[model samples]
Target chain A: MNSSANSTMPIANRTVFFVSDGTGITAETFGHSVLTQFDMKFKQVRLPFIDTLDKAHEAVRKINEAFEKEGARPIVFSTLVKTDLAKVIFASKGMHMDLIQTFVSPLEQELGVKSTHTIGRSHNVADTEEYKNRIEAINFSLAHDDGQSDKNLSTADVILVGVSRSGKTPTSLYLAMQYGIKAANYPLIPEDFERGKLPSCLPAYKHKLFGLSILPERLSEIRNERRPGSKYASLENCRYEVNEAEALMRKEGIRWLSSTAKSIEEISTTILQEIKADVRIY
Target chain B: MNSSANSTMPIANRTVFFVSDGTGITAETFGHSVLTQFDMKFKQVRLPFIDTLDKAHEAVRKINEAFEKEGARPIVFSTLVKTDLAKVIFASKGMHMDLIQTFVSPLEQELGVKSTHTIGRSHNVADTEEYKNRIEAINFSLAHDDGQSDKNLSTADVILVGVSRSGKTPTSLYLAMQYGIKAANYPLIPEDFERGKLPSCLPAYKHKLFGLSILPERLSEIRNERRPGSKYASLENCRYEVNEAEALMRKEGIRWLSSTAKSIEEISTTILQEIKADVRIY
Candidate 1:
């Protein structure tokens, strides 16, 4: 599947280019946000590692070809840092949106310092210490995932508690991957519901607990795919599990949210915002 | 750990805010890209879900407070869509960068259509079919991870083959989560090396195979942490395994890259680029 094109959606009517000097992931993210405001289908293309002048000319030719074939100017979103490369691409047949230079020049004026204007530094891949720590965080999240190990539970920055398929696993992984957060998760199982108590391992980590609940209908639909016609997939069972989970979280005074219609990014960002200390909520 | 601050880095002398009426992910991505060009430190903060005028006022207050405390204008990167909220935030003490409206208005003019300007549409969570497909891809990646299954080998969009801890699992998962690609990964263990051929199941899907190799030194370091003093962690074993795996991949005529120092994001992006069809290379 193309990253920007949905399979079930209509065929793309236009071409969009994410041109960057390095990985181009940041360019893609910026383009997606602005392009999402319009209700048009896009066939996205990425031109990465376009650092040299030769690569820049090649990129322009590609853009022109896309424009000529589509019978419309391809919309180009570029994060090219070098002045020469940007100069070449800006004059292509495509409509250019300079995502970097527009903001960077103004900020340079504000800070009274020139930007380095170097390529491949967008996310700082050269900082080995920071890189090592990021990998460590990912390893930690994997180790503590799905309540697999409680050995280092005390060191977790956050603990996610919820019923199965309530978005705990994916959310935990995203937290670690995107933000370098150390997250652990535990499922609220049938035994815990029957006992009407939190899991045994969670009492000592009450302050780190965050809960995720889901609508019973959505939970049932998700379970049905995994277990088919089993009792675990029944609506009644889903309702009981969701209600018990919510009640347990409430009794335990854990902060919670419903993940029924939310994206994993949404859930992770909200968790970070709510847990954000030092910022006063007016 | 804070999302933007490394643990051992210096104290932040600047305040940075990522504010959006919906999730602030787009704002954060854009901010990080631009801020990375400078030599400075930032105390990063996020203010999300500022849809209402009341919440907009609260966000402005927080920005102003940060500016006063830091004794400089806090750098605010905002993706708010509402005109009124944008006006309110633009007047705050912080130097605001309107990420949404900067290019959105130009695109609206170019397309000859008014933008929807709706809240919570940045990544399109409302499209439930797309959402379900994304979740399905993630589940598919997890199921096929680490040679865990061969049931759906033919269905994958890409198959990542690498030695253990050569960065296959995380790269596979990132490919799935970030781009909705169905990825399966397999490890090239001693048994496969001794056989002197590709894995039995992979022969049928040769067109879909991509390889990841690593430096023997780094591989040894990673394994030592997992099993201290074991033969598996010895430098000689790592050297032999890496050389044998690379030789096998070369003999099979498969394209491969080193994963020794590359980030998971970099590896996934390169995979997509190499696999991308229809775009001309000039």
Candidate 2:
């Protein structure tokens, strides 16, 4: 039955290009994400660092080649900052979706000013202090990962407490990298459950703490992959840990959420929103 | 001088909305990145989880309100999958940039097939193995950070070596998070400089190694922020460490790049391109 169903499905045979004046990361990210909404698959080509007029012309030629070979107008998603360069690509046979120009003019008129019209300044290292803060946040998170250090608990903006395999590490790193937040995560262990309280180091910083709980089945599956056929991977153990952790969080009046159904982006965004952190820098 | 210059600069007064049926992270990221190319700022609003027609109408109402108040057509970047929902926003006074529809039609014609027209599948947790791989990569990178663990030396896809504060940790973490590459970073300390060779554990995995170097002045500045008025933070010391680290990398025939001026994204992209890693999953 599965083979028959698969045979009836149509195959994808289109080409797509992400053209940019800089790293092309933004074009590719936005383009791929939008493409995923459709069932069609694409052969994606990235043309990065197209800063010069000559490079832009070369990109147009390549795009035209794809158009001719495929007998279809290939799609082009571009973030080109220069108007002249964007015009060159816009003239190509492909259908152009200019990300920057489509919005920049309206923004300029609304602000009653002109744009900088610069290339590669969006994610560049133009500001030193922002870069320093990102690095410092990364370092702080690393030092305090898995309850490794106790020196700077007071300095942390948010201390994530959760059971093992409950996804505290990735969420912490994402918070730091994306929003420059100083986040530290500590794993709640069986000892903490026996003690019937939070960790000793967390009492002074209870207001800054956030909790993550996972479904018992999902937690058991994740733990089983790490250490197979162990008591730590047992379903009964996972259920007990999750229950105790939730109870402790509710007793402490701390905010908590389930990591079982959410992605890292969702988890981090929810934490930032719940904690009322300033997320404008992102 | 700074206060006088700041007073002359105009503040931005435009409102921008990122409307989507999912997390809206892609719309926000692409919109904000493109907006940064211009000098004008915006009051940004994100309306996510808009999966129904009623919710879509609410978004259109909100967008039109912004337009009426500002007396300008606000910019709307949307990734809504449903045509009816997207059309509702398109009819608003705001300038609507339908990210998915702008390209999906060309792609459909090119492929001679119809799209699945699914919602919320781009970054969803529909597949278990992909999530497991991401978590495993994060765990591996964390365990091997700063040469802390030698147990998984053979399992790493890339090992980053550099002097302290050359951005090995953040780059490693970014690679793991974005591309699911198993990355480990080792700090090249003074003891390694005294011996004048690569670390003992790195000799067997020479082909899998990448090096990060930074400007001496920048390195000194970064170190000084951590430990002020120490020999380790001296410019002369920083120069010695960076020079020796570069020499060691060259002698070992390893690829290296300076992280002084590049963003973490740029550095990671360069390494991925040079190493020929399969980064298409991103």
- Highest DockQ scorer: 1
- Span of ten consecutive residues with least summed lDDT in model 2 chain A: A1-10
lDDT against true structure, model 1: 0.81
B102-186 in candidate 2: lDDT tens per residue?
7677766655667667775555652435555666787899889899998978999899999988999899998887667899999
DockQ by candidate, in order: 0.39, 0.32
**Docking level of model 2:** acceptable
Model 1 misplaced stretches (Cα beyond 4 Å)? A1-12, A123-127, A277-282, B1-12, B124-126, B277-282
> Relative to the unseen true structure, what is the C-alpha lDDT of residue A15 in candidate 1, on a scale of 0 to 100?
87
**Candidate models: Cα lDDT each:** 0.81, 0.78
- State residue A108's C-alpha deviation in candidate 2, in Å: 3.5
lDDT (tens digit, per residue) of candidate 1 on B1-282: 212234454444568888898878788788878876766667777888888999999989998998888788888998988899999998899988887779999988777778778876765473455566667888898889888898888889899998898989888878877777889999999999999988798989988999999999999999999999888989999999999999999999888999877878778878987777324211
Q: What would the per-residue lDDT of candidate 1 be over residues A79-197, giving only the tens digit for each residue? A: 97888899999999988897788899988887777877877665536235555656677788778878889888998889999999898988887787777678999999999999999
Q: Tell me the RMSD of model 2 versus the true structure.
A: 4.5
Clashes of 1: 0
